[model samples]
Target chain A: MNSLMAIFRFELNRILTPGRVFWWVVVAAFPVVIMLLMMNYLQPPRGATQENINTFFTIALYFVAPTVSCMLGALLIAAPAVASELEQHSWTYLAVRPNGLFHLVLGKYLVAVVWAASATIVGVTVAVAVAGIEDPGDAQELNQDDTVVAATDDRAVRRGGRFPGETATDVVPGIVATGEVGRAMVGLAILSACSYSALYIMLGTLFHRRAMVLCVAYTAAVELFLGFFPAVINRLTIQYRLRTLLFDWTTQSDEFRNSGVLDFVSSDESAFMQVLWLVSWTAVFLAIALVSVHVREFTSASETDV
Target chain B: MTSEYLIELDHVTKLYGTVIGVNDFNAQLKPGAYGLLGPNGAGKSTLLNLLIGQLVPTRGTVRVLGQSPRNNSAFMKKIGFCPGFEGLYATTTGLDWVTLLLQLHGVRSRPARARAADCLALVGMSNDMNRPIATYSRGMRQRIKLAQSMAHEPTLLFLDEPFSGLDPVGRTEMTNVLNDWIGLGNSLIIASHVLHEIEALTDSFLLICGGRLLASGTASEVNELLFDSPSEIEVDCSEPYRLASVLMDRELAVSISVEQKSHGGDTVRLRTLRAGQLWSQLPDLITRNGFTVTRVRSADDSLQTLFNSLLKIHRGEI
Candidate 1:
């Protein structure tokens, strides 16, 4: 445990340089910048309903904060954990210590997760605050078409048998309240960071020479492609669990929930089950990474020459 | 492997694919100081790596402190290795780097910091310990590497080319530190190609060439090997021809050649198998013949020549 904390503290200090701090700021500002741009240029028409605006913010926040920001942060930090040490020829110094390899892997993995999660959480919070939620009074005025209001009311009732004004604080003009969605997005962002960091760290240990390339390929083929395939394999993806949790936590409209477009997300699993699955998969990846680092031989190019 | 020996390698061979790294090497090093002397690519680094458990032997076993070194944490705690190459993190300060390494050995933060300071000071890096390593010179970097290796106070230390970047004064300082280390009853195996560098620290040597142990003994023993080998001596003299005749008459030389010098003199170069006998009889022969010898020097006094002779002996050539 002491060695693990030592590695963690050392790596944290090593990465807090000016160059790394600049990149981290870029990652954290990404979602906020996109949200500001969208709100300015893609605003709803003068008489447009509130459902369109809410959907835009919800989907945009989900993709930008939880998906892109977290994925990029984890990829940049975790995928090169072992490769950087090898390239710098510093592995021999640490490898000679007692349980050094194991602690090194675990400590770096934790730093990656924490760093990526913090960036995503900050990005999501700032984006949500800047793209302010729509007031129900303004929605009632802009949504002038009586047919659209009745349809929204029916959808809200189907969602949880609660009208918009019946419980004004609990229900927003759209499917769920802004506070509930913001909390759920933050939770999902953290989970995304943990899961992706674990996967990339495992890849780093298994393929030190080509870890980044292999991680990108895995994300493209398995996580992004197979995640939306509407097959049994989709359940094996982190994206599917995250999407399921999002839907379960916010209680989306029944029509959208039953729609065949998002058939990849499992409706049967509860939110707790999805969280358990994600945590279990993270543990498995971390276990494989620790084992690989412990058993495999890693020598620098010069050492190999000797 | 018995606990009596600090390190034991029994017929150990390490093969990097078809290339041999260390060939069928066998040694039982007791607790003491010894030098690993060899030319470049002579398996000195490879032998150190094997001893530190970085690489496993292909066909034999290696034991350090009476236990297998491969993945042996307890054994790791007892040994420290300073590699030939510089492997420092460029962003961290010398003190923090050493302290962090000590922490990896299970020392707490406060005590690790104090120990790191002391080790850095031992290497004469007290003032510059807070500077980032990127700002350090080659010699300072070498000192920091040495400090990290001994910070945990291991029972045995393996240093490969530790004086590679040190100037004369720095070299002397590091030699004193190492001598002090040995004086404390710690075992050391310092690897270097320079004969005098090793000679300054310890007389015991493990001579290697072509990934094999060619010889192992004290400096005098190596000198004895040189004395027994066929060697050449060049003598600048006033009467080279007469000296050559006298040397041949006494059978002190196997072959002798005289060359005319540009300065109106001659130099007699003689190859002798019995160098000890030649040296003993040369002054008397020159005095009796009234030969005026200006200068005399041996051509086979370097470590390379000694290694060549040992290699020949290993190959059954002489």
Candidate 2:
């Protein structure tokens, strides 16, 4: 217990110094600034209604949040825990210490988890606050439209020929049943942050020296190709689970949202399935994280010959 | 292994594939200061790693404090180590690194901080304790690594090339600090290639060559194995030809020769064995003979010479 805590504190303080904190703030701000810029150009000129404003906010949370969180986790946690140590050649010193390797991994993981979750919360909070003012009680709707409107997989076609507009009676009842979108957004934020944290920690642990490169490849694999599939495929993707939890939080729209077009790491599946898959898979990776932290040979035995 | 000895190695051999690390090594280090003497790649590092349970052996049992070193958790707190690399977290100050390492072994933060201070003081690094290691010089960094290991107050210490990079003054300072450590009842295993460094701290030495234990004991014990065979003695005399002509009958002086000095002077150097044997039979030769003897030195007997002789003898025997 003492060994673990000592290593934990060392790992934590090593990465959370003032300089690192400043860099992290910049990385977290990138998505928010971009989201706001895009939303401004797309917002209707005079005023926006419930439908358009909710749709914009949904796009921000679904598309912007995951990219920011995962990248931040990798840079701050995975990079430091594994890559920085290798570059510093501190692994040689750690190898002989009684329990230095385990401490390093734990410290980086815990700090990254906290940092990722907090970034998501702050981003989502700002986006939600701005959206709520523009369109109050806009996201509580459940089903968007009864009529098959588009003759396409993209929308819930309605009795009318065109996409449902703001104040369209078809969307009001659906909003009333599902409640607002932000509450569910927060929960998905927490779960997705934790899952990504576990995933990065595992990746870092498995490949000691090149953990950063390996993690980048993994993020691209899981978050891009597999991340685009619908509910069922999303069940197998990290973003899907988080997105499913936020499905009800999304603005009720007559037309379907290509979540990836508006979202990422988001799923069309039920929130319950999303939670089950993300949390359970995350739990297994968490085990990998723990064992990797414990058993990793921090330093290579190959003594360099100069 | 016997319990009286703090560490005992019996026919220990470590091999990584076909390359030998330690070949059929045997040693017993009692609870006192002992220097491991060897050159680079001479297996001293491997031996220390094995002693601390950092490594497992291929064919030998190494016992530390009378228990197997491999995964022996209890003995860990009793052992301290300062590796040759001297690597520390640059972001963390010396105090932080030392405190954290101690905390891992169950020391509380408050006490660890205090102990870290004391340890830094011991290594003459207290003033620089708050500075990050990145700002430290090579010697200062070494001092911090030393402080971390000593902060634990371990019973057994393994310092690999602790004095390697130290300047002469730094080496002297470290030698003094090491004296303080062993001035108490603790034992230390210091590895170094400098023969004088080992001679300064320990009389018992383990001389390694080509990954094998060539000799293990006091200097004189090793010397005995090297020079136990009779040695030749040379004497510069005024009448070398006359003395050489009469000395052929001496039993022990199997070979005798007289050579004029390189300057082509009258002086002749007499090579003989058991000069006393010749003196006993020709008592008058010492006092009445017109012979002024000038030179007497070992035929092959400086420490370096004896060390070489030991290696040669082993090479021939094996």
| Top model number, TM-score | 1
Model 2 over residues A117-194: C-alpha lDDT tens digits? 677667666655433332223222222432212233122223111243433333321111113655665566677677
Residue B256 lDDT (model 1): 92
Q: lDDT by residue for model 2 over B259-315, one digit each (tens)?
A: 666775444334344444543554465456666666645554444554565566667
Alpha carbon lDDT of residue B74, candidate 2? 68
DockQ of each: 0.52, 0.28
* Top candidate by DockQ: 1
Task: Write model 1 residue lDDT over B33-151, tens digit each, in one string.
Answer: 99998878888988998898888888899988899887878888988889898989998999999999999999999999999999999999999999999999999999999999999
